[model samples]
Target: MSAFLAPIHSWLFNKVLLFQDIEMDLRNKYLEIYGEEAREIIEETKNYGELIDRTKSIEELIDLSNIHGWLQNKIQNGESRVAVILSIFIDKYGSDALKTAEDIFYNNGIKQGQMAKEKENPQNAKDIFSTLNNYILEGMPCDRVQKLIQADEHIVRWINTSCVHRGNFERANADINLFYKLRFLYLKGFVSSANEEYKFFETNNEDDYIYNIEKA
Candidate 1:
């Protein structure tokens, strides 16, 4: 945190920015539907933290002396905002709002997948899995939110060692399962768009969810 930003710092920062971007998209849609009523929740979200200036590099905006804490705060702030916005809309609009949120996640995932393909040209399930991690904001790299269960030419399997979104969603009175479902839409979109041969899936595993990327 001393003006010595590593690749991981910028990586985490980018994921946070992506998360915020989705929040902004939700805000815009809220305004379109609820108009003035959306103002209250929109302002409430701003109270969490100032949005990051995405055009600028993380190096220019992050707190040099508290890099880890700063990135962690971004994740918390973005997740809380997302949870609040989606929860309110879900309460008001029910399945309709959920549909819009799903579309946002899925379409954004496709864009990210396409971008990752351009950069990495991922040729296998494991490659797609790695690229998915690059875009997913799971926690700090040290937190190790994901654990690889297996990997080979045909597939890659993993489980969540920890969840960084549950607390935020719970505090906002949102369903954590819904959040995971939406994220899976994003991942499904990502894998398909990243490589037509790859597909993504998730299933219940007692307390933790198991995720897979495999040949279609």
Candidate 2:
């Protein structure tokens, strides 16, 4: 099953031995799980995309329990491919519901590393975190940090719990996207809010465990 689904990990997202065998081979795999007639119907389907949509809906056809566990697992293994799939899924579903940031956004995300490099900071993310942590530590920068509290679009959704979400702590790529959004807080509030200095980052620490949608 893993091998059969391997192509899906690619941005190409699918693989086939031959044009004629494309539907047949995939159907054969599905048959092993869903039965012969289902396989036949899939093979006969006119549109490969329609068949794919249907196949995804069948719990018996696709082992979602396993898939769900591995849904965001691509970063640790096939990062580029996983990011591709994540981007596709987010494009279709919209990022409004996902609190942190999904793999899709991460696959093609902002380059904090590049930005930090441009800013001459070797550790931009770490620097941003330290700044915020210091703000908490000193208690002298409440207004300064508050100006930095530009919540991400998914921040509210992440806390809602009813929403499906993703972010950096979830995956490296997603983290970048979240950071990109959080960085905006500085743009929106920092320079304008108070007479203080706080480095800008793409994301803020939401006072929760790492990747906790409850606090994103």
Candidate 3:
């Protein structure tokens, strides 16, 4: 690997492993709750983790936007029982599961931000926003954020109209409040890691947000 790309490759590999760990944790939790039924669903869902592990290039990882579709098809059409079993798991364990993933992503972002600062190349708004967005994508299967070029360059606005996380929550009948809380935690983590003063807002639509990077 080239010198400039080694760290990124390492990071991606570690992320794949982290994804697997989270999957295993969720599988165990589901097994504890639902026994054999959960096992079958987990077995069927193992491909999700395998796809991450088999991703050999960053571009391949970035192209993994179809995860939500795969999940939906699996749950809705693969087996009738899977929908109920998976819903139960999500309703009961979704918050905790998502929080765990967020913590992993957040800590990694903090470490990367610190590294950049120590190198005397403090990240800018674009860089920070990109990193935050990437962390979200890494932690979950979702569409990429749509960056808007606002008149104020210091602020970054983005829209995510299709959130697989939200879809999952809705499908599982999970509390929407928990999804909001997770979003807050993710944004807060990004701000702290970037070490920037900023104002953030989530829209009533629940899928859009703005980040004012350089707060006066």
Using TM-score, give the best candidate's number: 1
lDDT of 3 by residue, 1-216 (tens): 232334544454444443333344445666775678667666654432333434365444442454334333432322222223344555556765455545543454455445444543424555556555433332223233354544243666655444445444455444545545544554555555555554344554344554344442
What is residue 136's positional error in candidate 1, in angstroms? 0.6
Cα lDDT of model 2 by residue, 94-198, tens digit: 554232232222211122223323443323322434322211111111113222222342221111122122432244244435333433432223221211132
Indicate the TM-score of model 1.
0.94
Worst 10 residues of 2 by lDDT: 134-143
Best first by lDDT, ranked = 1, 3, 2
Better of 1 and 2 by lDDT: 1
| Rank order (by TM-score, best first) | 1, 3, 2
Per-candidate TM-scores read 0.94, 0.18, 0.46
lDDT of each: 0.85, 0.29, 0.46
Which digits, one per residue and each the tens of the lDDT, describe model 1 over residues 55-84?
A: 888878988888889888889888988888
What value of lDDT does candidate 1 attain over all alpha carbons? 0.85
- Distance from true position, residue 120, model 1, in Å? 1.2
